[model samples]
Target chain A: MSFKTTVITILIYFYAACGATAQEPTNYSAKNGLPTNHVYDVQEDKDGVMWFATNRGLVKFDGKNFKAFTIKEGLPNNDVWELYLDGKKRLWVFSKSRYQSYVLNDSIYNFATSDGKTISPAPIYEVDNALWLRAGYYKFDGAEFKVQNDYATFYHGGSQQVFQKHGLNAEAAAVSYDFIFNQYFLIKDGELWFLNADGTVLKK
Target chain B: MSRRDSQSAYRFGNLFILINDKGIIVINTIAHTLKHIAFKDLNIFIQPFDTNQKCVFVNNTYQISVPNYLLIFNAGFELIEKHPFPEALEIHHAFKDSRGHIWACSFKKGIFLYTAAQLRTLYYLKGKK
Candidate 1:
């Protein structure tokens, strides 16, 4: 279908799915709650409430209403890479714009951007008690992750933007983490996946 | 790929040799149509949980399918033994959780951890905001 049609269809689908999972939840969205289109990360609190990391804010979805957290109020950054709910149910975040994190105690961890260079970020996931994160140029110890002295992948903004814009809305874009397979996968754009580690499908 | 295989019964596919959920290094293929394909030491046709839409049929001593909940297929693919899990209507994975119950998910039912012995539904995700 056309790009505009596809985008419309996707938004419709998500709105439908929102109420399809929980029968009695008060939602928070762009209209009455959180702002911005980029929902970068999502997590569930120990209380079973859910939180969404968006481009402008962090949204807390308590199955009834949404409460948004932003830099002005007390969020680390606007561009979050991933959201992790640790064993203690504290929220840990990974970001692409700046170096920052959120602790369970509602505190913010901030890092400054001193150099004139912009650092690209990468995928982040939580394993065990520690956090495993990859920055576009390299792995960050969570301090100030700067661009490499010479040149590197992490410092490449153009490539990172392309990767970030590749239709996370398409079915081809959905990613599932298989603990058993130990690999992150999703159908490549325009590629037909026949048999996946999940199940087999046949296109007519 | 479709243009090339438009008239054929099958098209080019990817194959990965899985040790089954067991430990047999059997071969597997991810293709659109398996009826027209041929192979050796073939067992059962099952799918593994890879993020990609593609599916693989590793082996078939006792086949596995997640028609139920969401959790770990954690150990990796094995074809030798049958590990008991929640019955899936279209499940990719499942969990027994803390209550000796099987929590299964469905494209129809958002999520639910079931009662013991697979007799009834205990808790399900209420889908309405």
Candidate 2:
């Protein structure tokens, strides 16, 4: 074979090898010991164990096998919605029933107020070691959540006119606020608009 | 957009990531610059709260789950790699474990695990003539 033909052959083999090495993922489902296939969220504990919140129950995967926990194991409900791992490694489980519970020492416990009232689920924000909900702030007092007054306040102003003035249809936009930067981000019709805290358009 | 259509914005370091059914927009909050990537196939199953888990920052790269693909972008908002999933699988979120394995949760199918190779070095073996 000619030298030119050999070099071309080698280059073709090299490109083919590169394409074959692209990663392929492995799937796990009910056929492989998962409690159910409808997994809502996944989180990793401090011990490097993966936990998944599913419609049927909460699952624990130890890199090899899947172990599931259900209402019988103390979950508020089987339809788990979300899982959050706090700084202390506590796994906070949110159920579709709007019940908030936390996993400590492998046991699921529902969150309640100090007065024994069930607390409603909301967007939880951790500020200065306290958990702040949309309604107010609460702190865990060894056994239950207690209300705290020193929670951080979030922005909730009506800025529809500001968006409309900037040529965006406010009714068709979705808005989110950044507390740290004190800015508002609006998205509509595949365009993103940025605005200052005072509702002045910064960018489009 | 329907009333139930999901949309959200998250702050990651100096960048703010905004997602809707249309596409994803990444804004550099400090520089007041923005970058938008339109989605070819829209995944409307994305819940508003699920946005917090949609994108993960690891090894200075952002791994975002969009429809049936996991896109990896550099810090400067440049697409470095794209990993496609089965058309039947719709990824809801992607998380990178401490061991560097990416675990993707699907809407109907089960979770998928991708163990990325640590190094990619090519070698040529010569055969006897």
- List lDDT for all candidates, in order: 0.38, 0.65
- DockQ, candidate 2, vs. native dimer: 0.36
> Which has the greatest lDDT?
2
- The sequence of per-residue lDDT tens digits that candidate 1 reaches over residues A68-87 is 66777655566554455544
Best by DockQ: 2
lDDT of 2 by residue, A13-131 (tens): 98667545533467899888887888777888878899998888889998899988899998878877667666456778865443468887778888665544444344444434444
Q: Estimate TM-scores for all models.
A: 0.38, 0.65
**Which residue runs of candidate 1 sit more than 4 Å off their true CA positions?**
A1-28, A36-38, A74-76, A79-81, A86-89, A112-117, A125-130, A137-204, B1-72, B77-129
Best model per TM-score: 2
